[model samples]
Target: MWQKVIIPFSVSFILIGCSEPEPLVEPSTVYQCAALTLTATVTDTGLDIQLPDQSYALVETISASGARYRDDDFAIEFWSKGNEATLIINGEPFPLCIEEGTLPTSFSARGNEPFWLASLTGQTLTMREPGSEQELTVEAPRLVEDEPIMTWSIAAEDGLNLMILDQYCQDSMSGQSYPYTAYLGREGEKEAGCAGDPRQLLEGVTWQLAQTASEQAPTIQFIPESNVAGFAGCNRYRGTYQLTGEGLQFNPLAATKMLCDETAMAVEDEWFRQLTEVQSFRLDAAGELDLVLADGNVIQLQRKN
Candidate 1:
């Protein structure tokens, strides 16, 4: 015969705990990756990116920790910290080092990442995936003269590419044309004005002669009223100018009838001759203006800032 035994409260609790165990529950965690919608131009050599309101050559720095884009059933992500960056295509990761103050040409040195067969032709961009037969293409937006808009294009993957375009559209409420990208469908801040106002970029800025043959460097000023004025080392001159697209033309310049040293006068004469041969213009990365002449001569001008 078994004898009935009494257990303490602690023993009874231990027995209950041994009879059944509680199920474990795991916490759900979510990882957030920053997504960026940038206008990408895929070219034969590489890619070009810019803000909707800025020039293709000039792109504003994005503050996001990372940017992601998806196309052709594939996704690409970029993580940027300072000048160093990492790009993720699908699931594979590649390291990239970005150059400051300018646009990048390639994905660091790792642009050949088994994907993105890219090419560009005119305003069309074409791209194709490696090991796949299908391709994707995107075309750039069109522009009209005096429409306050500029455009650039990129082609991805050997005739398969994407075109990115920008337009200056005024907000109905503000009555101001903000930089807008139709490809991304978003408007950015004043940085969109990074392309700068065409008038301000052309007017009232002083350009000092750079690397000229003259003993005294000449200078030129393009005033806002379309008047051009500058000193030709020995004499001050005034004229009218017209800017059509990238073409720059100066009307006949009238100079003060002042005679100076023989050498100085000779230099002035050459300066005036070079000025009359101007055809087009180019702006370098250092903000220097190159007034290209018909004879392939460049009269470089350093902006006074």
Candidate 2:
């Protein structure tokens, strides 16, 4: 009798030990989506979601693909896959929500017609025009009335001011879309423009002259840290380039003294002249780089394989 009782108790203990353990709760994660930014914390039984205006407690539900959470009381649903997510509220779906990149500390803006460029880094604002440039040390930009707009006021005699709005902007000339709209004002003059980092399009690619048919066409490579080196038909050239907003300028390039044939030297001379005249750059529909000259001409270049 004692043997039977001990066997039954041992079996009960084994069954209890084999029971499933509690689910582990994950740490909080921030998601920047297309429609909104939200923070989500996965709990053992549900998910805690925090939005800009409100918060919701969501429970895990069955999903065909990806993870799905729902809060019936709030009529909210969230589905996530990899770094992308979809949010649903009141039976409306907000799809194609992607994660955001790192925040930027510096910004650049440029306008057309008169053509001006401005870069803001820390407390220094650098303004550049065709033949002039000025740097101003000013206070930090202040947000305007809880809106996504920033304004910088300068105490200079010229009454220079800058305003940047968090809005989608398209370049007037290049047709490229930017993330910010910018306005620069000075003494009754205000210039409207687009703002973003333009260097991502130029860096990490070696471009060759597309307009030339010669076997030894001019090739240019833009390196990081404001350095540029390239072959200018007859000789190799090296220089530092300045890129601000939409503007691009090669500062006093120096070329090697190696002499080539008359044809090559002529090509080099023309290339250098065009480089000097370049005021801005745009990528054509075919993805070729077009260096826009001051006189409305374009020297096209193709990406080297």
Candidate 3:
């Protein structure tokens, strides 16, 4: 009897002592996904994030209680009933629209500026610019609004339109306003201020074929104010032009069908395709011709010097 009791009691004591206690920790915190992010994730799982290049992503809540315990995972931004964060996309001046959600969309990656999010609200508000006036004023919405508000301007360049950020314009009388669109040969516009007709600007400017799909060389030339001609790979190419209120019509271009890899013509072909809008052109004080697109991309053109 004594032997059995001693053995069982010893075994029980050893087993109880072998178990370890739970470790201490702190609760978790979540952060919004970055605009330039390759991936979307919430820090703690409460707020959502809209990617700079991609659309918005939603975050799922973590079901946990007490402090010092959390499970981490990668996720996109999403909105829910309790979620309340005010996000002003590019300072449109419109009220923030909060709803169940739009839909999963791809990223335009046009232009995204720096901003911060504090809280969420359903009311929609637009950041509006008081129209232009003749006389200058000290206090006005254009001038009074803080930075991060007046972020971008629109202008045009060679065969391309630019939506420029970091570049600015002021009403002068009041302050600055958001210039969303542009019209050529009109007020508040640049005629490329080069030599002769718009076509003369491309004169002597050697635009090489950076990309091609065929063996035939394209008939590349500047059609003064109307078109850009040449061979796009194998497609015999002829592009018609329009300005101001008109649209650019690519007249069913033709090209040669030959095998080729990445070339200069190919690269330029792609660049031209992406240029849907031209915002502005400026011969900066540095004597550089800067081309800004409607999508807010700036390309500097040097005079082959």
Look at candidate 1 and tell me the lDDT of residue 87: 44
**What lDDT score goes with residue 189 in model 2?**
83
Question: Which of candidates 2 and 3 is the stronger one according to lDDT?
Answer: 2
- Global lDDT of each candidate: 0.48, 0.73, 0.31
TM-score of the candidate numbered 1?
A: 0.38
lDDT digits (tens) for residues 164-233 of candidate 3: 2222222222221212111122244432210111222233232333333435433344343355565444
Winning candidate number (lDDT): 2
Q: What is the lDDT of residue 282 in candidate 3?
A: 36
Better of 1 and 2 by lDDT: 2
lDDT of 2 by residue, 1-305 (tens): 45544444433434445668887758877765432467888888789888776798899999999899999675999898765677787865543444443223466888888798878776677989999999977556655533344433333334677766656566897655565677878778888887765554565457899877455999987765677789999899988888764578889999999988888889999999999998887766675678888999988899877
Cα displacement (angstroms), candidate 3, residue 4, comes to 99
lDDT of 1 by residue, 1-305 (tens): 99999985653334433556675543211111111123444333333433323323222234445433333344544444533344455564422323222122321000122333333333333334565544334344223232344443333334422222343332232222222222211133111111212233344346888776667778887764567788898999998987653467789999999988887788799889988898766565664567889888888888653
Give the worst 10-residue stretch by lDDT in candidate 3: 103-112
The CA lDDT at 212 in model 1 is: 62
